[model samples]
Target: MRVVTATNAVKDERQAGGLVVEVIETTSLGDRSYLVSDGEVAVVIDPQRDVDRVIAVAGRLGVRIALVLDTHVHNDYVSGGLELARLTGAEYGLAAADEVPFERRPLADGDVVQLSPRMRVRALATPGHTFHHLSYALEGAEGPVGVFTGGSLLFGTTGRTDLLGQQHSEELARHQHASAQKLASMLPDGAQIWPTHGFGSFCSATQATGDSATLGEQKWINPALTLAEGDFVEQTLAGLDAYPAYYAHMGVQNTTGPEPLDLREPVRAEPEELRSRLDHGEWVVDLRSRKAYVVSHLAGTVSLGLDGPMVTWLGWMIDWGAPITLLGESREEVGAAQRELARIGIDKFAGAAAGTPEELAADRSQLRSTPTATFSDLAAALAGDSDGFPAPEVVLDVRTNKEFAASHITGAVHIPLYELKDRLGEAPAGAVWVHCGSGYRATAATSLLEAAGRTVVLVDDTFDAAAAAGVPMTEPGESSSSS
Candidate 1:
C-alpha cells in the first residue's frame, strides 16, 4: 500500500504495482472511489455521484478514461459511474443482474478486460452485497497486484447483506459467506484487498479491523472464514439494524438510470428569503458547528453540522424531493456542504445563506437556546434535586443497541438515531434530553426533535464520562439495564 499525498483526503493517491489507483474517499459515507490506470487508460470504480472530482483527477493524470465500472448499484450514495462515463466518453460497465435500464458493457463472471497488453482486469461475480455486486481483479506484469473487493469482502468483515430488504436478508447473507469463501480460495495470499466500504461505513456489519488487511491475514482472522454457512447467515442477520431511509431510493434510481448531476454554483439567499422559505415549509439545514447550534440558533431551524455524515442524515431525515436551503458559517463552508450533499443526488438547492444566528434571524424572537447537558447534568436532573429542573421529560439514548446495551444511563429512552424519524411519536413530548456514545448522533437527535417543535437537550458528554460521573446506570451483563 503506497500512498501519494496531494491536496487532501478527497483526491488522495495509492499505488498497486504498475497501477495508480486514485482514492476519492467521501469521509461522510466512509466509502472510497478508485480511478485506476495502468499509465495508459483509466477506469473508475464505485464513483461518488459528484463526478467532477474523478474527472479532475483523470485530467491531472493525463490518462484517457476508457471505462467506468460500478461494483453494484450502490445503496449508500447515488452512482456516478454512468454519469462519469457519459462525460468522459468512457464505456460504462455494471453487473448484468443489476438490470440498469440503459445500455452499457454488461460485466459477467470471469470476463477479462484488457487495460493494455500486460495489464488487465478480470470480473468476478461476487454477489451478496445487493445480490448484483462484482469484484474486479487487477493483473499487472507482476502477477496479481490487487482485487477491488467492493462490498463483498472488506477490511475485517463483509458488507452487510440486509440492505436489500428483510425478505432477501437471509438468502443474501448465505451468498455473502460463499462469496467471501470464493474470493479467499481463488486470490493468492499477497493480493491487496481494496474495498469500497468498511473503513468507517455502517455498511460494514461490525467495526473495522484496521485500514487494510491482506488475503492471507483475513483467512486466519476474519470471522467470515470461521463460521459455517447457516451460522454466518444467522449471525449476520442478527447484527443488522435500521439503515438510512434514503437507501430505499438509490437502487431504484440506479436501475432506471439516474439523471445527470448539475454541478453549478449554489445561489445565495437573503435573510428575508430564508424566513419566507421556512414559512412555506421548506427545510433550511444549518451546517454550523454543533456547539454553535446549541449555543444559539434559529428557533425552528434544524442543525445538520458541516462536519461528519451530513449526507446520510440529510437523506434520512429530510425528503429528497423537498426544496432545501443551506446555512453555513461562511461561503466556503456552504460550498463544502453543498458538494457533499450532492453525492446523495440532492441537487435542489433553492439557495444558501452564510451568517450567524443573529445575522440570519429576521428578529431576535427567531433566536432560541437549546441547552447541552452532560451525563452529570442528566443524572442531577433524573434525581429531581437539581435546581430549576423540570423533571427531565425524557433522557433519550440515540446510540445503536450494541452501544446502548453496553452501558446506558438509567431512565434514558432508547431510540437509535436512524429510526428516530418514523418513531418520533414514540418519544415523550417536551424537554427531551438526548445522548449517544459521543455527541454526533446526539446533535442529530437534537436537531430532529427541535425541527418537530419539541425542546431538545444534547447530552454532549462521553459514555465513560457518564459512567464515571456516577449517573445511575446498569452494566452490560445486567439482566435489565432499563431505568
Candidate 2:
C-alpha cells in the first residue's frame, strides 16, 4: 500500500540525551532529510536541493550548524549537502572513496566526528545503494540513539542495487545484504532506524511502509533482517522495477556538484507567447489539478498537476534542459512547482503564467477538454448502455508492469507511463479509455494522448472500484477477454 502521511514536511523530536532529530520530509520525492541537534549543535543528513528548509529548522531550534553530511551520492534528487554546508559554514563530509571535483571532508568507515561533548557521529561503510554508501551512527551520552541509513537499510526494504547497472546489480545486492547484517550486529535492537530513502522513493527495492521504526521492530519485518543473505539477494533483485528516467541525471548532478538553486519566478508569458511556445514543441505544463485540467485547459499544454508527482513525471519525460513553461491558477501554485522542480535539478524555466484556462488562453478555441470517468462509467460504456457515454474502442492501462500483473481491467492495453513517450504510436488507433492504480498517472497519460490528437477518456478513480463496478479483471497468464 502507498504510505500516506498527513503532511509532507514533519519533524520527530524523539531522541535520547536531549538530542532532537527533526525529519524534514520531501513527500513529493518520497525522501527525507534530517536535522539532528543536541540542544546547541546540529547536523544535517541527505539534504535536498532547496537547503532553505534545513536552515529554517536549525534557526527555529536555535542550534549552531556544525556539520552537513550525505549518506550517499543520491540517485533520486540533487543533494543540497554541499550548499547547506557552505551557507552555514559547516563541515561537509561524504565517503572518502567517492571521487568528485569539489572539496569535502572525506569520511571513512569507523570514523567519528565529535558534535558536542555528549553527541558524535560514527561512519560505517554500507555499500548497497552506491559503491561508497555510508550510514552514520549517532551516539549520545546514553549510547547509540540511531543510525542514518541513507539507502542501505530502509524501514522494511533495502535500496535497489540496479541503479548502477545490471552487470553489478547482483554484486551490489550481495554487498547490500552484508551491509544490513553488519549494521544489525553492531547496533542494539532499541536503536532507532532513520533512513533517507524507502518512504516512497524509487531508490527502494520495494515500497516501504511505516513512518518510524526501531531496529527491534525491523528485525521482524524488514526483508534484509529476516531473510538469509542468498535469499535476500534473490528477492531484492527480483522485486526491482523501472525508476524514473530523471534518476539518470541525479547521480551525476550530486557527484559533479549541482547548480545553485534558482526558485525565482520566471518572466510572465502572455497568451500569444504561450501559444507560440506550444506550437514550437516547447513544454507548456498546466499545474492545475488533473480534475480541473481535464475539464478545460489550453490545448497542447500537458497536465502535470502540482497535486501529483509533477516533478518526477515532468523531469522523466521532458528533454533535459528543455524550455519548460508552467501554468497555474495562481502564483502560489507556480511558485510551489518551481521549488519542487528545483529539487530535481530543473533550474531553468522559459516562463510562467498564473490564471484560469479562460484567462490564459488567447481565444476560446485554444482551450480543450478530455472526458473524465470512473470505473462504473467505464463498465456502463462497455455494456453498451445508452445512458452512459459511447463505448471506448480501447482501454489503456498506464500503471507499472507489476501493478498490471497483479490485477487489471481485462483486455486493456498495457503501457507503463515512463515508456509512453517513446511508444505513443504503439497505442492502438481508436477512442481510448485509460486508467492507473489511481487517477494520477492516468491523467498524465490522458494529457499525452490528447496532445497527440487521440480521443481519450481519463478514468479518475481508485483501482479498487473496478471490481465493484463489475469491470472484468484478470492477471498475467490468464485467458484473453474480448476487447
- Each model's lDDT comes to 0.81, 0.88
TM-score of each: 0.93, 0.96
For 61-176, candidate 1 gives per-residue lDDT tens digits of 89899988999888888889888888889999998776656889998999988877757788998889778789999888776777998898897788998888789888888889
Best by TM-score: 2
* Candidate 1 ranges with C-alpha deviation above 4 Å: 1-16, 384-391, 451-455, 476-483
lDDT per residue (tens digit) for residues 26-109 in model 2: 888989888888789988999999999888888887999999999999989999999988899999999999999998999999
Error of 1 at 57 (Å): 1.8
Measured with C-alpha atoms, the lDDT of residue 459 in candidate 1 is: 84
Report the Cα lDDT for candidate 2: 0.88
**Root mean square deviation (Cα) for candidate 1:** 2.5
